[model samples]
Target: MEDITIHEFDFALINEFFTELERQGPGSPEETIRALGFIGNLSNKTKIADLGCGTGFQTMVLAQNTEAAITALDLCAGSIDKLNATAGKLGLQNRVKGIVGSMDNLPFQNEEFDLIWSEGAIASIGFEKGLNHWKRFLKKDGYIAVTYESWYTDERPAEIEKWWLDAVPEIGTIAHNISIMQKAGYIPVAAFTLPESCWIDNYFVPQKARQEEFLKQHAGNKTVEDMIAFMRHEADLYSKYKQYYGYVFYIGKKM
Candidate 1:
């Protein structure tokens, strides 16, 4: 058996976990279009920046949906390379490509973009902290839409609650998210929970298929089974407790 450390999967399992998927998280092109509507008037010349853009799935969606010149930024060089390759294949080389960097310390000028977007990536930096830190990069009245994890009800089953606490102990409620966005110097435009299809269709389906393939190839590795357990557990938990929490997409504009 090959000894594999946890972070070792950054290139292997991580790539398997998300490959050839249109979205890395719970969002759709329709939601992106709706968020763009809330941002109002915009031209093809609008400068946009997508932070923590894992593999640039939504970045590609943005390019196809809008004429904005997008800079898709991610910390992983491999993901950036993959994104660039996809953009090139799509003939969007000039409009969309990943710029390798971290969301913790943005390496860009102040007010560099007319719109700053991140879907399911802001959690690495706390939601409040992300809103506050990234606001500096948005032009006045510029839009920001981030998909954040939230609890739908304070009362939840003990099992699910424990699972969430073990994962993200401080995940906030929708109202808390809105309050944080307002306090972080953005005018909250709208908020909505992603539908179940966002989880089942886009992410879980592809991830499960890959996990099954991995398990078949590594039949004797308990480590692979254990690793895939988390993903399966999340899907199972959501099946039973979806109404209790969700990935809520929140949109706002810099004040």
Candidate 2:
């Protein structure tokens, strides 16, 4: 049993832990649809890129709502395979295709997508960098929609602020984020904070059963215990300081 930080855990272990859940992070289908409403003119001909699509939860939601062809990309092979299988079962295999790849190095042509969608995954690459880099893949007037952790107010409690800042140094106030998006060559369209239900009900609540099963299977594994403990701490932090910060959906049109 060795003491280690969450980041020190093997990537494969982390991916495996998340693959059992429908969502790797805080979000819901309702929030996904709400974000989509800001973007218009979608049709069968429209192409969408869903970067960091963990198991394609939101991707499936997108598929159900629109006729757009979606390329759901993620770094985890297991997640991609599961996503593809789920797509097939849901009869969305024709429109929703999952590929395993890094978000920063997308395998697509310039100006290829009508929409770029990412939920709870932009932090892997900094938000500003993701927006700037992904812009090349979007057609003119194309929309980019993403959910990133952002501060709800100008100031927050020191404990929560330090915790989040330590984890994601690039985190900023919603206004600051919008300004960054504008500077990165986009017209910020709509910005909204996901409600607490998305975190408490849609995200954390669903993990309980899976967490218990995971712990039972990995009984006596220190790393597994450490990972679950870390996740529980994150949930506690969110519950305690949810009023100060949460995931915010930012929508922008490529300028």
Q: Highest TM-score, which number?
A: 2
- The RMSD (Cα, Å) of candidate 2 is 1.8
Which candidate tops lDDT? 2
Ten residues in sequence with the least summed lDDT for candidate 1: 1-10
Quote the lDDT for 36 in model 1: 71
Give the TM-scores of the predictions, in the order they appear: 0.91, 0.96
Candidate 2 per-residue C-alpha lDDT over 1-255 given as tens digits, one digit per residue, 9 for 90 to 100: 123335667798899889999899999999999999999899999999999999999999999999999999999999999999999999999999999899999899999999999999998789999999999999999999999999999989998888887777899999999999999999999999999999999889898888899899999998888888877888888889999999999999999
Runs in model 1 lying further than 4 Å from the true structure: 1-12, 217-219
| Candidate 2 least-lDDT 10 residues | 1-10
Q: Which pairs of residues collide in model 2?
A: none
| Cα lDDT computed for each candidate against the true fold | 0.81, 0.92
